[model samples]
Target: MIQLKTREEIELMYESAQLVSKTLGILAKEVRPGVTTLYLDKIAEEYIRDHGAVPGFLGLYDFPNTLCMSPNEQVVHGIPNHKPLKDGDIISIDCGALKNGFYGDQAFTFAVGTIDPEIDKMMRITRQSLYAGIKKCKVGNRIGDISFAIQLICENAGYGVVRELVGHGLGKEMHEDPQVPNYGRKGSGPKIEEGLVIAIEPMVNLGTYKVKFHNDGWTVTTRDNQPSCHFEHDVAVVNGEPKLLSTYKYINEALGITSNEEDEFLYNFMHD
Candidate 1:
């Protein structure tokens, strides 16, 4: 069942979400050519712990890592390793944090250095699709509204939206009710309501949407061996509108990027 959060509970969740967002910002500065994902993972764990929140992904379901680091063709759930990232490679770092009995989850695909223009465009489109989906997360809309929005954008661009993986409602648990898929028919699925918080993620592949599981039982990669991009956000419905609980300001600052793309989704409390 979907557990709607109370106002106080939502406040606590905001704190948890910010912690994860901050962790991603720190990783942003460390993501570069010659940097190993395992090394970045270590730093992320320390940073999250130092801030008084536990690393949400480490040891969860016996998976060993503070972050899910997937590069290039790998879709998600890639385990951290000693392999150093190279120039032109893009890595998707999905992070989480547990604080005050709540969980915050988010992800971003970062370019190690200079990357292929086509790959870069794919990333941009995938990230834009995330917001498109978020824009539909209102009190009267169904989950399918959000899904269809994301799917239409990426599909029109000739990108493949991953089917095996889907976004989920989040609160005390990392994965909760209301699976948010990237593709669906409109007016279908559960109706969105106030106090409902969820993670909307779009995983788009540059080639076919078909993916294969690796033998490690964790990593997932595209069957056509083409690059993929993933972007995510934590959103909540309040006062009949969608409000963002996480911000990319830190990441953008680290990358020296200036964009107000998220301005429409920022909640009033975010400014305070």
Candidate 2:
């Protein structure tokens, strides 16, 4: 069953979401050549705990890391290791936090330094597709609308949209009802309804859409061995529209990137 969140519950989730947002801000400044993902993971774990919350992904399903640090061809669930990041490599940093009994999860692919132009373009397109999907999340649209939007945006850009992994409804638990896939026919899946909260994530690849799961039972890498990018956000259906509880402002600030990509999606407060 799809669990619809009350406004109060969504607000609580928002607080946790914002903490992850800020945590990303902290990581943005630290992502560079020679930095180990495990180091970053420790930083995130300590930061989340210091703020009175638990690292949502740590030990969940017996997984060993606090964050999924996938680099280049690694799509998602990349385990944090001592291997140091190199100049021009891109890694997707997916984070989660548990606060007030709710979970907030978000992900971003970063350029360690001056990355290859083609890989950077993949990152840009994948991030754009995330918003395209978010635009379809409203009170009346079916879940397929969001799925199709994401597929169209990335496929047209010549990027591969991951097939097996999908986003999910989120509230008291990490994964909830109503599977939200990146590829679906219009009008299929559950209808979007008010008070529904979901994590809309798009994992796009530079080559084939197929993926291979590592034997470690956690890491997932692209089948074509081509670079992939992942972006995510937590949103809620409110007043018949999708309201984003998480913000990318921190990441933008860390990278010194300036854009109004989020203007249309925000309302409650003024933003750059």
Candidate 3:
């Protein structure tokens, strides 16, 4: 069943979501060449705890990490390891936090240092597709509206939209109802309604959409060994519109980037 969150509940989830955003921001400053993802994982776990929220992903599924660190071809669920990140590599860090009986989840793919121009463009397109999907998350629209929007943006740019992994509704539990896929028909799936909270993530690959599971039973990679990008946001439908409960401002701040990509999705109740 799809769990609709109350305004108060959504506010609480926003707090949890902000912590995840802050956690990502902290890691952003350290995501340079020679830094190990395991090291970043340790920093995230400690920071989340220090802020009074538990690590949402750690131990949730017998998984043993605070963040899903997938670099280069790995799409998602990559476990943190001792291998150091190299220049030109990109890593997707998906994080979640549980606080006040609610959950907040978000992800971002970051460039380790100077990266290939083609890979950089893929990341830009994938991130833009995330907002395209968010724009459709208003009242009177079906889940497919959001899915199709994302699919269109990526496919038009000749990118592969990952079909195996999809975004999900989020609330008290980490994952909820209304599976949000990146590819779907224009007028299909569940009808979006007020109070619906979801994590809309677009995992776009530079090659074919096909992916393969690693032997570790955790990491997922593009079938053709091409680079992939992942971007996510937590959103809630309110008063016939979609409001962003999470922000990439923290991450952008760390990277010295200033963009108003999220201005349209800001909720009135949320303070700056």
Alpha carbon lDDT of each predicted model: 0.94, 0.91, 0.94
- Candidate 3 C-alpha lDDT tens digits along 42-158: 999999999999999999988899999999999999999999999999999999989888898999999998999999999999999999999999888999999999999999999
Off by over 4 Å in 1: 270-272
Candidate 3 or 2, higher lDDT: 3
What RMSD does model 3 have? 1.2
| Candidate 1 TM-score, true structure as reference | 0.98
Where in model 3 is the C-alpha error above 4 Å?
A: 270-272
Indicate the worst ten consecutive residues by lDDT in candidate 2. 263-272
Candidate 2 wrong stretches, greater than 4 Å: 267-272
Residue lDDT tens for model 2, 1-272: 99998878888898999999999999999999999999999999999999999999998888798899999899999999999999989999999999999999999899998999999888888888889899899977999999999999899989899999999999888989888899888888899998999999999999999999989898899999999999999988888888888999999998899988887777362221
Per-candidate RMSD, Å = 1.2, 1.9, 1.2
lDDT of 3 at 270: 52
